[model samples]
Target chain A: MDDKVSIGMDSRRITTTQRETTRPFSLKRQPRLGESIIQGFLLFCGVLSMFTTIGIVVVLGSESIAFFRQVSIVEFVTNTVWSPQIDEFGILPLLLSTLLTSTIAMFIALPTGLAAAIYLSEYASSRARSILKPILEVLAGVPTVVYGYFALKFMTPVLKAVFGEANVNIYNMASAGLVMGIMIIPMVSSMSEDALSAVPRALREGAYGLGATRLETAIKVVLPAGISGIIAAFVVAISRAVGETMIVAVAAGAKPTFTFNPFEAAETMTGHIARISGGDLSYASIDYNSIFAIGLTLFLMTLGLNMVSRRLVRRFREVYE
Target chain B: MTTLNDEIKSGLPQGEAARRNVASRRRTGAIWRTIFLSATIIGLIALSLLIYNVVNEVFGYVATEYAVDPATLSDKPIDELNKDELVAVLQDNMRANAFRTLERDKPMADRSESEVYDLVIERVLKPQTLETWTLRDSWFNKAAIDAQVASEFPEAKLEFRSWLTAGFLTTPMSSDPLRAGVRTALLGSLWMIAITILFAFPIGVGAAIYLEEYATDNRFNRIIQTNINNLAGVPSIIYGMLGLVIFVRTLEPLTSGRIFGADSGNGRTIVAASLTMMLLILPIMIINGQEAIRAVPLSLRQASYGLGATKWQTIWHHVLPNALPGIFTGTILAVSRAIGETAPLIVVGASTFIVTDPDGPFAKFTALPIQIYNWTSRPQPEFAHIAASAIVVLLVMLLSLNAIAVLLRNRFSKRG
Candidate 1:
């Protein structure tokens, strides 16, 4: 069936070209078995994406309704404490922790990622770019689980050594957030570099022609031109940082407390879901449904960020064209 | 504009001022260049540090002492014991029900004498990990390690163990970090990847075909395109939620295989996880497929039509074959991304530890990332060592898959 559809779909390109040359084409042609099959298959595939969106919404909404029926939506959203074990289902604690970790990660990722991007775009020779890009990609490809392990085993020990044992907790958010920042560096760098390179050489030449230094030109001209794409990278990286699970699961303690300190261990939304799902919860329990509510919240946050990213990417494309 | 040296020195803007301008600009450029180079260096250093950290734990000397040496149980060497003798050793040593449980998990009748003997060694003659040394310390301080072992643990065995052994890849997860291996997890990962590819590939390609070839530029198609792009960036854990409510609960009868009497009726089966992964990666697959198809040149299609072949015939003969290589590259990358994905599987109920290999699509499963996560969560130092080794396995798989992607992309780019 797949082969037949591929053949059918590819063959259509030929017929369109043939029709243009032949002239006087009529719309009322007899339907064929093969053409109909290909069309049906393609349409089915396209519509399945819509089905996936519906599946996500229906599943999340139904379970969230069950949760909100038992726990008020206003409380779930506004309450500061999140002790499901004690029957207090406040989401603010988890939301705050997620924000804290993502913020720390961005603080660490943005300057380094942007600087690396600028370096690659404006300074590196082609040979240097070729060698460095693939290596950076390798860093991106390292599994998050490995990063989690590195956070727990390596980074924690190093931090303890630096701050003294009394200052650092075994499962602090600092290590997880820092390691996650490292994991996203390549992602931000490559993306911003892509944007920076797309900034027309004419702009850079115009700056240089006016007696501007390379530093002045890159900072004043290219950075401003690629600002939308750089912001998009930041949003995408933040979304990724918020959604990361294993690093926080292994290093950041599953305490889920509302706190402003980065050194203390606290659960993010993804970590909470992983922690709850790993335990054996009986079917249809409120605990099970609570993860769904959290998931719904998480889904909406990422969706908004992704839409912003998409808009930014489109703006970046429009700048040149 | 020519000026005397005295005028320029007195700060008239001329040759000296212009030279200073050029020199200062060059200085600024050099400073920025150094800064950029350092940024690249910092990234490279971090990457190297991670690899170094993982590799540092894969091989080391472990000081171990058994409760009762198997050597004392039999006059003959433990490995040389006959099947009946090994069974006698196990029965004599282990509690009756514990023996039964082992047999229940994997039947004794099916295992070789060596296999049962190894189990006896693992379960009955349990080796307690006394002290551990990192790969670096074990190499440089071998004499000190030996002296400490001799003073503290006279009866203990001090041996260098490479955690990534053939047996490690062949054995199952265990409570003891020394005996724990990744056989079950490896199989689960392979099963999940297989099903994900099977489901996502055809559907993703079909969608790309429709969008690139058949669909007219309209509101609906534009909306579909936007949704696909957004879906590509959706947090993977959200997909886990979708899968849990859809595959694991709502469609349990279908996913668990209870309708066909194949599963034990547990909704959190390999089939459910695989399907979740399929959905998670479908957007990436569709976008990649479109890119590959769009790369096919228009001249090929026109030439094929000049020969009077229909659309499908032209696609099959010219455009698709050219696009196929690029498509493979994209699929390979998507699969790599899917395999490394831990968040979705964790939410979809990947087990922390499962000792038995999965029986089929509907069987319970745990993957390598989950195992690595589980091991790292344990407080024991030895488990951290094992976690490091598991990371080596995961990295090898990810790198090889990505290498294939890079090679295929280069191959296709050359041809196209």
Candidate 2:
């Protein structure tokens, strides 16, 4: 199928060319049977993926609509207390917790990840880079649940011991956010490293010839060139942090109270969904449907972030080739 | 671009002052680079420290805890020995150790034999030391202890056993370290991964191949592409809710419809969870697969057609083989991701209490992450040891799978 399409497309290109080929188009048309099979395979993938998205939207939308009918839109959106046990199943606290963790996570991750990217792209030798890159990526591969356990069992006790009992809780957002930050560092490093490497070498050499130091060249030239990718990395990392659940569920306590304090326990949308579903909530109940409503909000936030990053990446792509 | 300083600096480069300035600048640049280099090294060391912490905690249990000396057992046939003989052998060792300790402390002669015997039992049988506390090995049996006292140092030879052993794999979790094992959880994880792969692969790849090879680049294709990228970024927990609605409630009648009059689908079966994960990663697979297909060189298709092959023939014979490497890379990565995912599985209902191995996709199941979460949530100290061991197993599994993917990717890249 691919061959037929390519051949048909290629023949069309050939016919339009000023110089004509000897082979007639009819000979190529014979391959259409085989081409259609390949085309069918391709079409199947596209349609299946399309159906999946539609399935998600339809399933989520219908349930969310059912939920919203019971819980007013204002109460669900604006209220600070997110006690689903109450009549008002507000999502504000979950959103706050998600934002607090992801924001703090990015605050720690962005600088370290970017610096690592710079060192790999500009300073490190090939031997060092080959050894280090995989080790860095290993962070991403470690299951988030492991990080969750480490945060709750290891990090929480250490935080309390060092900073005092009043400063930390067993399910504090700080430890979860800190460990979550560590998990996201590799995502930023790898993406930013690729972007920095993609920056044309000519730009670096030109800066060097003009008497700028390697550090200056990296900061002023390579960084500027890779800014779009850097932004994309941050955006993706934040989205990842927001979407993360097991870590927050295990480490961050299930108290969905709105608070700016990192030392206190909080809940995220993903965490709440896990907690609620794990409970014996009946399928037809408002709480069950409310999960769908919260899911829609989470989905929309991440989708928005992904779309923005995608646009930024396309706009910033250096046509070096 | 011209300045007095530029001319002076350019012209003075041949002199000592210029040489010193250049050397100083070079020194500063090297120092700055050295700092950056050290930071990278430091970052890696931190990662190593984290791995070391987990490994140390796990190996520490395997090392100091519950490891009985094999020499103590002396290859005794316990089945031939009666219960009375077993009791006699145990009592003899109990008396010998107590008497020996009493002889060493002559001032304690006023103490009763019962008191001395109780002390002996506490010291030998109790998990007094970390080593003695974990001894569940075959060597820790009464015969083993009797033989060790006779052959080895009469006083110094003692049973050191592991609290965790092969039995840990078969047993359910208990408050006591001796009873805790991951058998049920392991079976659950195996079933979960098996079902997840079965569901996710065909649909994900099918979606990928369609978009890459068949679908035209019209408004519809653009919409599909946009939707997929957006779907890829959506929180995984959302899929769980979708599954709950679609599989648990809507499709309950079909799921509960048993052919042999058995309860087939309880809404939390492996099928529901697997289907949910499949939906979650479908976008990822489609996007990755599409990229893979797009990456296949245009010349391969042209060359295949130059031989007078049909369109399907060209794709099946030439284009697909060329694209397989990239597709494999995408599939492997997607699989790795699905393996580690915890949130969606949790929301979709992975039972923590599943004891038997799943017979098929319809069976209830759990995963490593879910098990780890269950273990870590509890307050028991011994559970931490098992949790660490479980983590080691999980990491090793993920690492090996990722290594295979890397190997496959490298091979494909070379071929391309």
Candidate 3:
């Protein structure tokens, strides 16, 4: 029924185009004034998103400029301490912690997410896929704040038990990073699954025709073919990890320390912003301005990754089609 | 084909070697399959563990020590006391000056029985929780906890407490975790979300309509499309910064209701937060709305046009009705996302503690997630228990919203 309607619509469209060409002297239908006004209003609404982007850039840029005037770029980049109380503003510790947590998150999410994607796309029956997909979505739908609670109340204690109680701080990057990874798994699995499923069925058939096992075909041909999309998913997940605030804020301690140890409590850029802002700060103070600078840095990092991910996703689509 | 098969068979490793190779490969396959399945199971386990961790803290054994025992205050029981009796209990126990102050604040004669009862409990009984234990510990180590509590606080009374009680839902915020409830925060969240939907839905759908139905392949439209996509990926905190600079400061007169002479303190009003949230979720709404609008088949639009309907008429009459369910699903999902968002609202200056319920958009507000974040950060163990209870509330709210969206989508898909 639907196909027939579409076919009839297509024919009508063809006839209309033909009529338009043949009757060039006929009056062109003009939209009513009210219709044009509504269209204009809709267009404004469409362009409103551009204004939002401009607003974000303007806000971040202006505040970051003010922040940079007081603190030298070299000191901000290279100095180890981030004590806003003492007028010291170095971004290294926060940046390092952000990188550390994101790295840890990536380490957990990438392999597990890819394996889950491969399993769902290549192995799971339709009924299993239907059941499993929504469960994964439920994982994603859980609030970040809940994950923060889990990180602080649950993950930290478990981490403490495994690595002696003395070694793990009550609030550490490891617990936050691990929970953030769990939060990001659905993103990775879903995106990678889309990419894997988009790989043409003929390739799988050809591999099977050559006596290749399902596992062999999936690992060799399908994985390579969907590699770009999987990479894009990884990039997006990493960006999400880098930008995640609550879990890190709740579990990772507010102390800005340059430490490689995931067990040690250190603040990420996002966490620092959340923690400092949550406290009462006098408006336009150096401490307040410093959060904007950190936010600008985070925004740029995530934006860059998102752009790269978009390009990779686009490239993947191009290659397959 | 037969000759090629024969050639391939001749070239292959014969019988036992080939069997061993195939068997080894099969074993590896089975092992890898298990590994992959376990990865999925790990995700499921993590989710369950998260739920368990929250549930474990929400219900437990609590030991309380009061300044004056309720049994000593009432002939029967404190709970069974009438309003006048409760008021008398409060007037007798509290100082004369304090009693006058309470009367001055609100006359006890005018207060309800429960209100008077609560007042007596607050001013007279002053129940202070001495210690708390998790549900698991309460179940398995009951004797241990009992002995510890008995040794530690001989005068304290121990009882099982479900932190998420009706009182927990109705009572306002308090510094004392025992007295604190999510009433203010829940109202604030609902108010902000209601306003957010009002602003975001139409604008989102309008933007989507323009993009899907009316957009010509032009540079401006392309820019708008790309901007919306990028805006969705922009860290939510940046939007908070935008709200801080724009709605909170630059547009303070408008957001704070000063222009309207309402005397809201600042732009940290519910309206400000809702607008900020509107911007944050606008991209998501527009994207989802676009998908929903796009899903309204071309045949429907063409049929309407064939009947001499204008674009707007066609969209209103046919496309919108067909797409309503999809749009609802998208909006609910977006609203849930907005509801869960903590970072942006925090940056936009949600009050960490607010007692009075938000009565209007201009009022200062706290949200459930912000409350949870604040509670979890506190040093007190009792705060963690309350935070877990709040988490349960937030999760249930989000889950129900999601379930509704899922049901809508399922029904729509079935029909489509």
Candidate 4:
């Protein structure tokens, strides 16, 4: 009915335009005042996101300048001690802790996430996919704070029991990192599955036509084709692990020590910021300013990784279609 | 084929050896397939363990030792006592000065029956939990728990307690874990999310409209697109830092309600947090909204245009109605994400000890996640129990929101 009405209106408009050829034709082309205003409003709304980016940069940049003015760049980078009470402000310990946890998280997430993605994309039937996908999403939807609770209450105890009570601290980086990995598994798997599913079926069939097994086709043909997206997923997951706060803050202990041991307790950059800022700090205090410095560092690190991930997806994506 | 001849010259077997090689390869494939299947199972198991852990902590057995037993305080049960009787019991047991002070704050005569009864129990009965056991422990190790509680606190009564009781949802925050509740935090979360939606929905949808309908392919638009993508991936904690500087400090006059002549102290208001959340989730909403808008077929717009409708009219009358369900699904998902967010709100200064429900956007507040975070960080075991209950509340809220989004998507997809 709507289509018929539109056809009728189309012919009526054409007849009217043919009858009144003297009227200006360009008037309809120009946007009316109300149209322009609405468009301008929408454009402003789009620009608002740009403003957010600018705000983050300006806030982080300005506060970080204040922090660097008081503490030399060399000392901040080179010094291992992070005792703000004693006027020592090295970032190495926090940076190392961040790296340590992210590395541990990657160790757990990468293979498991990849395997799950391959299984879902290559092996799972549609009925199985429908059931399993929502389960993974529920895993994804469980809040990080709840994960933090599990890390503190459950994972830490299990780790202690497995590794011996003497080896694992109550608030170790391993428990936090392992739980962070668990928290991000769905992100990794879903993204990698998208990448794997994008690999054309013909490619998989070609591998199978050569008498290749399902695992071989998935591993050799599809995995190589979707490598860029899988790498993007890994990078994005790494950035997420590095920036995760509550799990580390709740379970990974607040002590910012220079250590490589996952069983020991130490603070990542995010954990430090969250733990310190959660406490009462007088405005403009050095302690308060230091969190911004850390935030700047974290922002730059994650931004660089995300940019790389985006570039990988755009630059290396195969035009299978 | 040449490699096969080379292998044959190198003393490789022909038929049986080739068959064995194929069998081994197939076995390896099967083994790896099992590994992959188990990987998926591991994720599901992790989810189950997380739920089990939270539920385990939410209900259990507690040994309570009251300073004054409720049985001794009244002829009838303590709950059945009238307001005046409860108030009289409070006066009899309490010091004169303390009772007078309570009456001075709010008259006992003016208080409701439940309020008076609660005060009577809080002050007079003072049921203190001596020992708490988890649900799993109470189930499997009941005998052991009973023995320990009986020996350790002979005066204490052991009873199964569900921390997530109806009363738990209605009460306010208390220093004592037994008396604590998530009412204040839940209100604050609702207020923040409400304001966040009010601001973010329009801005996000408008941005999506501009990107999809109005803006042509250009450097400026592409930069905006890339900027939004990067902002979406920016560490949420950095957004918290941005909120700390921009909303909580620079915009103190506005966010603190000083401009409105309301005496909300400082800029750590729900408005500030909500705006910060709006910024954090805006990219998500815009991206989702863009997808929803893009999904509206061009033929629909063309049909409206063919009917002598303006571009805006086509969008408003035809495209928007068609896209509304999708937009709602995105908005619901974004709001659910905002509900669970803790890091940004913490930096925006969510009060860990707030008791009063937030009455306006400018009021200081705590969210459910923040409450859980604060409780879990405490050294006391009971706080963990309450934190788990709060987790249950947060999960239920998020799951319901997600279910709505899913249902909306399913219904719309079916219709379309």
How much of the real interface does each model capture, measured as fnat? 0.71, 0.72, 0.70, 0.80
Evaluated on CA atoms against the true complex, candidate 3 attains a DockQ of 0.65
lDDT values of the candidates? 0.87, 0.74, 0.90, 0.92
DockQ comparison, 2 vs 4, better candidate: 4
CAPRI band for model 2: acceptable
Q: State, as a TM-score between 0 and 1, how close model 2 is to the true structure.
A: 0.80
Better candidate number, 2 or 4, judged by TM-score: 4
Ranking by lDDT: 4, 3, 1, 2
DockQ list for all candidates: 0.57, 0.47, 0.65, 0.79
**Cα miss at B350, model 4 (Å)?**
0.9
- When summed lDDT is taken over every stretch of 10 residues in candidate 4 chain B, the lowest stretch is B7-16
RMSD to truth, every model: 6.6, 11.1, 5.6, 4.0
For model 4, report DockQ. 0.79
Task: Name the regions of candidate 3 deviating beyond 4 angstroms.
Answer: A1-26, A316-321, B1-7, B70-83, B97-107, B110-115
**On a 0 to 100 scale, what is the lDDT of residue A312 in model 1?**
78
Chain A TM-score from candidate 1: 0.89
lDDT of 1 at B29: 84
Candidates 1 and 3 compared: the better one by TM-score is 3
